[model samples]
Target: MQPGFDDPVFDSQGVFRSVMFATAYPGRIQTLESPSTAPTPLSRAAAALCLTLADIDTPLWLDEATASSEVIAYLHFHCGARILREPGVAVRFAVLSDLGAMPPLSFFHPGDDAYPDRSTTLVVEVQSLTEGPKRRWTGPGIRGTLEIGIAGMPESFWSDWDLNRELYPRGVDVVFTCDRSVLGLPRTIKVES
Candidate 1:
C-alpha cells in the first residue's frame, strides 16, 4: 500500500492487526498468508513480520547462513529496510534462519534506562511448532494467566531468558515463526518452569 510494489493477496492492514493482536495476547497462535512463495525457513508468519515491521527506519540482521543476496534483495524490495552485520549495533529487527546456531539473545540491544523501547526484536524460524512440554507464563498481556507449550526451542534459551527477564524493562522480545503461524514472547512475559 505504500507505493510501487505489486499487490499482495493478504490484506496488509489485516496482517498488521493480527500481529498486534498476537502481541497483545501473548502465547496465542496467529496464522498469516503470504502472497508469494518464500524460501524455506521464511514462513508466512515471518513474511508477514518482514512486511509489517520492516521499513526505511528499521535495521535487519539475518543469520549468516541465511544472508543471501536474494533474501536481502527481496527484503529490501518489499520492506525497504537496511541490513546490518553486527548484532550489538542499533537494529530494530533481526531474522534467524537457523535457530540452533544463533548467537545468544543477549548479544542484541537490550535498551537502557532512558530508552527502554530501543531493544531489538528477534524473528526466529523453527522447524515446526506444536504443543510440547507444558510451561507456565505470566506477566503483561497475560490475564493472570496461562499455561502453554512450545516445540523446537533449546533448553539454553530458557536459561538465557531467565537472565534476560531479570533485566526487566531492558530486555528484547522474540517471535517464533513456523510454517505460516507465529507466537509472540514479549519481553514483558515471564516464562516459569
Candidate 2:
C-alpha cells in the first residue's frame, strides 16, 4: 500500500488550510507543497485532498477512471474512507478523473435546505487550470470578478454549472486538481463563459 502524509497530523492540517483558502476564494489557484504520492491515475493534489477531507465518516465515490485498485487501496489504507460501489446522494465526496465523462453535477448529493453542508464535494483531475476557455467568476470571495480557464471540461459544463448554481445553498462544490495545484469552485460562485 502507498504511504499517506509523512506527518499525518501536520500535513493534513496544512492541506486542510490550503483547501479552505481555495474554497473561500474561488478562482484562486492554491499550490500544495510536498503532498503525499498517489498511485497512477490519481493526481497528487486529489489524493492529498482525499486524505485531508475524507475520513471514516465520509463515503467517497470514485468515478470510472479513478476507481483503480491502487487508489482504492491507498485511500482505504491511509484515510479509512469507505469507497462506494455506486454513486448516490449519500456519497459525501467524489473523485473524477475525466471531467468530460463525469456525471451531471446534479447527479451527486446536493444537500437539502435543512442541511446544505451535506452536499458532495467533487475532486476533479484535469489537464490544466490555466489553459482552457476563460470564464469570469463572481461571488462571495471574489471582489468583483476573476477570470480563469480550466482544460478538459465538457462543452456543456458551464451550462450545467448554471443549473448547479441555481440550487444556491444546495449544490455540489468542486475542487479542480492538476498535479499538485488545486482550485476551488464552491457552489455559491457564478461563472460566465
TM-score to true structure, per model: 0.88, 0.96
- The digit string of per-residue lDDT tens for model 2 on 1-193 reads 7777888889888889999999999988999853567897988999899988888889899998899989998888888999997778779999999776888887888899999999999898999999998999999999999989999999787888999999987999999999998999999999988
Model number with the top TM-score: 2
Candidate 2 segments exceeding 4 Å error: 34-36
- Compared to the true structure, candidate 1 yields what TM-score? 0.88
Candidate lDDT (C-alpha), each: 0.78, 0.89
Residue pairs with backbone overlap in model 2 = none
Tens-place lDDT digits, model 1, residues 143-166 = 886776777677788888888888
Return model 1's CA RMSD, one decimal.
3.1
